[model samples]
Target: MGVIIVLIGMLLSVNLSIALDELPCHFLDSINITDGNRLANDDSIEFNGLVYSRKQYAEINYVLLRDGTDQITVDPYIRGCICNIKPCVRLCCPLGTLNTDDTDITVCQDHDKGNKFEAEVIHKNNETKVIPLERFFAYIEGIPCNFVYFDDDYQITHKGEISRGNLSTKLTHQNSCLHAGLNAETNEVDLRLLTCIELEGDDYDLNQYHVIRHQIINFCMLISVVFIVATLLAYIFIPKLRNLQTNCLICYLICLAISYSLVIFVTSFGYPSFACIPFGYFLAFSFFSAFFWLNVFNFDFWVDFQSKHRFKQMSERKKFYLYLVYGFGGPCLLILFIYILDNTVQLPPNMRPGIRDGACFISNILWYFYTPIGITLTINYVFFLLITLKIRKIQQDIAAERSQEDGSLMQKALNEKKETCILYLRLILVMGLIWIMEIVSYLMDNFSPLFLITDILNSLSGLFIFILFIVNRRVLRLIKERWQNLRGKATTNDNDTSNLISRSAAFMQMNPILTIK
Candidate 1:
């Protein structure tokens, strides 16, 4: 017994000896910085350059609780360090005085554990209802529990969705199941299995540790949007660029611009919570519209390769209008599908659009957004294959039999198609690689250090479009011609005005008496 006492004393001395700075800082899970939220540890937020490990935060928070420090001052200094139980959870932390579980967060598991519960809850602007949920806690310590997820929209949410388990549940119902490690003056770190849930509790405002990172991302996206708008203007103002092909390019750029701009707006925190769904819907439409137009561009090229429609550009106005329907209208249908799902009661909680599930915007990215994008990309690939086959057949036919005029016409059309194909290829390569990086980053939870690569590529997409379409030799040549025409017309108009003035002066001088009358 004396030896045991000596060992315990040594352990106490060791714990006391370690300075606050020596505690191990929890590593970031993703550079995208999910709901983990620049956490200094499981309990404390890294605030005003202050940091604390899980053990350190709990101990300090407990000390403050004993000293009667109000939550008003404590909230900014700590997150997930709860004295009250209503909003905090203990299941993830541990129950009982000596429970040594190291789980730092009250995160929902990917798979539900044990039996599920049908939680009776208030539906906002609607009647009360019972939601069948699998996971346990509605709150992770002091903060409302958030889902663990990887998605494409890091900017709009700048965080993950708050856990749905707690979303609709009433405070009383939520309080019952909620548990968190508390520093309430106890023999050791205290845990209350029950009776700790408060009627009301302090709200923790999660401090954003690196605000500059998000600002830089938004600025880059805004810059890309400006370039996209510029490309649209270049195409629209030039009459020579109003051909069906350029019109298609214009449509794509317009959608691209709208999407990028919306990204800036939503992420900038310029809108209210009520506007999240609509913002998400429009953003989805713009992105899908851009993708659909790219599909139309590919399809138009494939048809041009067919000898029968060698001059498809001549009567392409009608077809271009139809292509607009497919481009714009298709995304409408997709958005409609999402809305239907969002409103549907039969769908599981996780499968839903999740715009409000946690982070806002279309949170179920795989189902609502990327899936449609993948399908469209696959169709574009098919068109690419067909174009390759058609080109081979045309070359064979031209070699086998052709009159001088027919061969020349065919050869000219062939060169145009080849040039257009190269342009399409470049566009596809850029967008495709970006999308691939995005998916990889979304799925790669372990590679926090590498999120920068994918994010930079994403922010540079509009800039990529500017380079691919606007900076090309053909567009530049047309811009040059348009500039010279404007200059020539300006010069001619000036000369004509001078000549008229001179004639008027001569006439007035010759007939001064008549002019005075």
Candidate 2:
């Protein structure tokens, strides 16, 4: 039931997005539309008044102009009206009141070829709208205007004159004819039909960013895959070469190697282009990492175990068993437990590969929530405690044996003890450090806000393995030794002539008169 609900929700959301995207480019039939038939501009239309003997009239037209181009012909569908409000008052002709309306009528009037006239919205539907004209103009400047107007004057001689100027200044300024009557009892002006003219600017398309981001994400996935494969092969094919194969360190490499490969494969190659990387890899590798460390932990156990000490150096089977129990067992349990939780409860967003972009690592759930952490800590603590007791007993036994040994043997035993303890401590420290990183990684994956920082730090897990295994002191020493050996061989070859000369001289001395064939 729950699965069905989730599926339904996902389908609905995706479908809605697709549906909205599929709509025609010209969605709104505004008075004025921009290029691509998108936004409405205010300058697309102009309304002008028709004058007569003491009376005037109005009409309007819709004009289709290419975005950013010159004005075109007027449309006949839209209409405008012009009327005189109060009787002709003061000779100064303070302001002309044109009817402000809901219908498409944009009025622009210059009372004098000299008197600067302005239009302002006063009484709309016979009620006072508190917003002032200047305030409204400032507010509307940001928003796309659907209507535009020009001053069209019809002469008494049946001739019309078109004065070209910004309709906004006429409508917004105080003294313009488009302004309402300030006198409250007089002043009337002529209003023409509102015009619709198409205008144009920026907001044309918005899909470019989405496309670029998608491609970038896919590119990252591809690169990550390549690196994963290369690093994994490097480990698998390259022999220990030195201290590279020493402890649970290989586990770290294996975890990262496998994790990234899975991430790339899941993200780059699947149905719908990507699939949620199955948590199985995380479960497997994380556990493997833990298990490997556990093996490092168990080395002390195997070395101190009665009769097992001799087998440790020679028996591969015993080593394998120790590794399996310590490194593999705990992580297996932990991963399975996490898997169970994932199945039973909704995992955190990070844990679940975005149904959109398929990849997953230690998500916020494991990092922030202490459930998995507390469990891991408890297990490690118990193992440490057990190992500590074992180590103490081993020390005690060595001490007892030391007292009975002769002076020379005692010294040898003491030296070996010191070396073992040093190696043991080093192993413990390295392993502990790796574990600490694991915990830190989990915490960071959960709580860290900076994505780039988290990503860089996440690489630390893999990087530590690469450096430790690929460039350990033991490995470097082996390389150096091999280089020196090769150099020595080359030197001997270079001395071949000297050896031959000595041999020839010796032969001549022995045979008094030596003749060459």
Candidate 3:
């Protein structure tokens, strides 16, 4: 009898262990949705919870299971069984097909048709002494089967639409999923999931395009730095290049170089949050300074073409000092005004100057940056047109006087007008094209192509100016002449050293007898 009792106790122990193992054990809170989406697609998760169905969708019987930490929708394949007494009346049926009018109590089944199930609960009870369903068997912690038939309000979450166990919507400035898989060894998707659903196809292509765009911009900036520095040095050292027009060009190059340098610096080494305001300030100032100097040069060109004697009366230094106020001081005043407005006025969040979309750029273009730039560009364009007509009229006058004057004099006159026209064309190509592309890019809804064009043109402006104005035949000639002069001076110094050495040898020879004595 003792042996039989021990055998019965062991049997009961084994049965209890099996029952405990089959009980709902996994907590919904511990599982990450992104990880669960990848690894637990076919895996069954069991949790203890109450099924809360939407009141309007009573026929479909789709329900949400809320664990203490998180919530997930259960599959519609779940079946309901009623248990009232020792022997429960088990009616196994699909979610929509369940006729619960005759039965008030039901235990959630693990499978649709099989008898393997757990978690007994009361369903649709209105009595005061009713017991709520405490245990729930969630087949999957994600969207229910046939989710497309559900209404829009059903899947909305704080982050975005909860679709197929993934947050398919995007938040403001969100880039990638926080819970995306990092380990390759795990059974998970390796690609970084986007924060938003890809409504338009070719998301990978778009990402690649942005990467290429930045690469091109960096390359152009590097080229601009090298050429602009060379141009500035040439203007400073070479006397022939130091006219009023070239001085203005020097200022423009300086501003362009600073702007490009700041862009590269911010891109390579990201600034802190506090640096955004200063960064925006300097960046806008430099850009505006560049445009202002370009306008100054345009006006100077028009002045030279329209009234040569009057332009010559204004000394290069005087012109530079006068234009400096407009070129540099104008941006300073604008920056000061913006700072005051930012401090005194309460602007919208979008209008404030701070880091947005991962870069320190002016967020409000219409008021702060673009408007001024647009006005300056319009003025420059008007000057450009007037200068073109002036050049044409000069050419016509020179042609008429060609029969009266010497051939050489007429040739020289024609050459001067030609040079003026070339200069104006170069200026337009460098400044006008870039700003036009910028304006078009700003106006367009889809700016992929326009942004590419704008970046390329704007970044290469310094290069264009250097090539057209600074690296020309005249500048090259000056550099060559200076190099030749330096070489001649070095040869003369070598000859002088040789003569001094011979003189010392002769003196030693004369004093040889005296030294011997």
- Top-lDDT structure, candidate number: 1
Tell me the tens digit of each residue's lDDT in model 3 across 178-273: 111223235322211123333236855776676687788988998989989988988887665566777788888899899999998877777766
**Where does candidate 2 stray beyond 4 Å?**
1-252, 260-274, 279-314, 318-322, 325-364, 367-374, 381-458, 461-475, 483-517
Candidates in order have lDDT scores of 0.55, 0.39, 0.54
Angstrom error at residue 143, model 3:
24
Clash tally, candidates in order: 9, 23, 0
Per-residue lDDT, model 1, residue 181, is: 31
Which 10 residues in a row give candidate 1 its minimum summed lDDT? 25-34
Error of 1 at 33 (Å): 38
The local lDDT score (0 to 100) that residue 493 gets in candidate 2 is 34
